[model samples]
Target: MDMRKMFGFLFGLMVSLWLGVSLALAQSGYPQPTATTLNDFAHLLNANDAAAITQLLTDLKNEHGIEGTVVILNSIHDYPTGDDTIEAFATHLFNTWGIGDKADHKGVLILLAAQDRKVRIELGTGYENQYNDEMQQIINEHMLPAFKQGDYGRGLYQGTRGVIATLTGIWPPDERPVQSGGGSNSPTPVTTASSSRERSDGRMGILIFGAFVVIVGYLILAHIFGWPVGNSRSDDDDDYHSWSSHSSSSRSSSSSSSSGSSFGGGRSSGGGASGSW
Candidate 1:
């Protein structure tokens, strides 16, 4: 019984106790064992278990042919409790639904659909405001009603349906559900020119902003160096205009003298010719 030995024993005891508690909580929380995902879906499909077959069919419904989605969220708080929290439930959902693993860093997942137009929701137990209960509420009030009334095929059809509209600022009325499509007959939505234009314009705006910054820097540098902005011609201080004027005057004088000499020579030639002939 030295102090160091006692401390070490206490630490070990705490770790063991925490693990036991977590295991217990998980069992109580989800009495049935967690089912495998698509990775295990294929195996379950071939497996003889009735329960496994049902889960696979559920996966098919959750992971059907949806693509191009959007989601917006304000905030979500994460529970610091052990793995038995809502986060665990969410991980289970994502796996069954074929949504990839995601970080629970911010309790909020403003999930912008990467490729598949399906929405996946995850809530952390840490958030009191956004605990599993609230999420269940969203599912029950907003989500489930759509599914039950519209039919799984007709309801959101897929997770992305209503969520996409919400992101696009056109969420269906509270009572309505998103339409579903599958196989070859489903009509693909044609994106309007305006949205395409907006995307292009957003890119152009970035480029233009960058160019403007460069031009401003160029002007500042030019001002500092006393260089002209564009196409500048510098004049010499050493009589550039004066030199041109002086040269022109000299040329005029020479021309006048030449003319006078030619006239005098012509007159002399005429007078001398009369005498010599």
Candidate 2:
């Protein structure tokens, strides 16, 4: 083929491919922010769950003065923001929606793609230091199990709680609460002598009362029934087994829905992790 014809054919092919990709993305149901204030655009959450999550986010902002949102997408196969990893898509979505405080950039986005079986915890520039490890732990430990079991609601709920706890220092990444009574680096101080003495007395009184009650009960039982008590181990085991079966059946029949909203114009430099189940 002549150079002119060949160039024209190549350009046509590129345009056709681009158009095809565009069409696919259009059909992929890429989520659009229905309302800036109303989180859960994808409608992954049911009405009640969505309301609860929105309240939690609002409280987080009110208490800590930080903005955080959760975004759940049906799939990311033809994500509108470009065919990218969940991490990249999350970052783009976070910035596009502008999630956190405009000046401090203190926004956090927890993005979950149900069909893709992926999750991402994308943090704004302001939260990178505080949230990085905690976010990962939340995803790996709390969210993954629920996602694997198709419990998206539980996953999002636990993940959001983890994020909140981490930021507020209520739950450190180590899964331990910060000891309240000490200097920044010092160990929590031992209890005072008077407090310890009171606790000891309290324990002793409880133990003596418990022993007396047990002795009285045993004497009454022995007098009425005349010796050793009958063992109820077999009956207890049967009841436990029945309860376990009922619980297992109930768990298997459960389902969950989730919803989320757009961000507050916060930007990211690709600072988050991604995972799949």
Candidate 3:
């Protein structure tokens, strides 16, 4: 019994490890593109100075023929734009750069001057879940390698590279549908549908597996403790013997003993006759 439980524990551990590795490989681990260097990317758009942001986006659509939009925000309800304001910048960018005619597709943010402003890039709903922290880090760390030496176009290249990789793997690549060829006609926004489903399935699987493990563990503990779920008295009664020495046997025994007592007399007449003679 003890050995059985140990085996179960080991099996569960192996399954969990496999699941983790599979998830990592599926989401992250995108090969970094070598065709264009981040520096070269920066120069393509020439987005070091204030006007470079606009040029970088134009280059993405015209040169690379990428299909997407860039979002930017000026201000919102006097919300202080600071280093901690990632959401504010993202929101502003979404509205300003998200829907535009400048790129004929999507525009990656140049972040021309946002020292006090928080900066973020959202990949239409399509890439929101696909573009995870790994991809985001590539942009933050390498795209803008050095604030002094880096250009905004480099950041766009790195960030958009992640997006393009994801789209190529999952959706159509080599052809920018949403950017041209009647793909941009629709204004109805897209949602992150696939990720939501995956998240829901993941949570449910955890709950189910957790519940199963707990139940099995409890049963194992009870077996070792000798706990019973029902009464044991019925089993004991089935093995009992019947008492057959009833009062009928006692009545016959008493009659035999009484008759013997009355018949047990000595003959005294013979002794009296001998004395008279």
Q: After superposition, how far is residue 105 of candidate 2 from its true place, in Å?
A: 0.7
Which candidate wins on TM-score? 2
Q: Against the true structure, what is each candidate's TM-score?
A: 0.25, 0.54, 0.29
lDDT of 1 by residue, 33-79 (tens): 12222221111112222233233323332453111211211111111
Q: What tens-digit string does per-residue lDDT give for candidate 2 at 51-131? A: 656666777888788788777665665343465688778877777667787788878878877667889988888766565
Q: Report the C-alpha displacement of residue 176, candidate 2, in angstroms.
A: 22
Task: Work out candidate 3's RMSD over C-alphas.
Answer: 41.1
lDDT of each: 0.31, 0.61, 0.35
Candidate 1: where is the Cα deviation over 4 Å? 1-115, 120-133, 136-141, 144-199, 229-277
Compared with the true structure, model 2 gives a TM-score of 0.54
Model 2, CA-based lDDT: 0.61
Better of 1 and 2 by lDDT: 2
lDDT of 1 at 183: 21
Top of the candidates by lDDT: 2
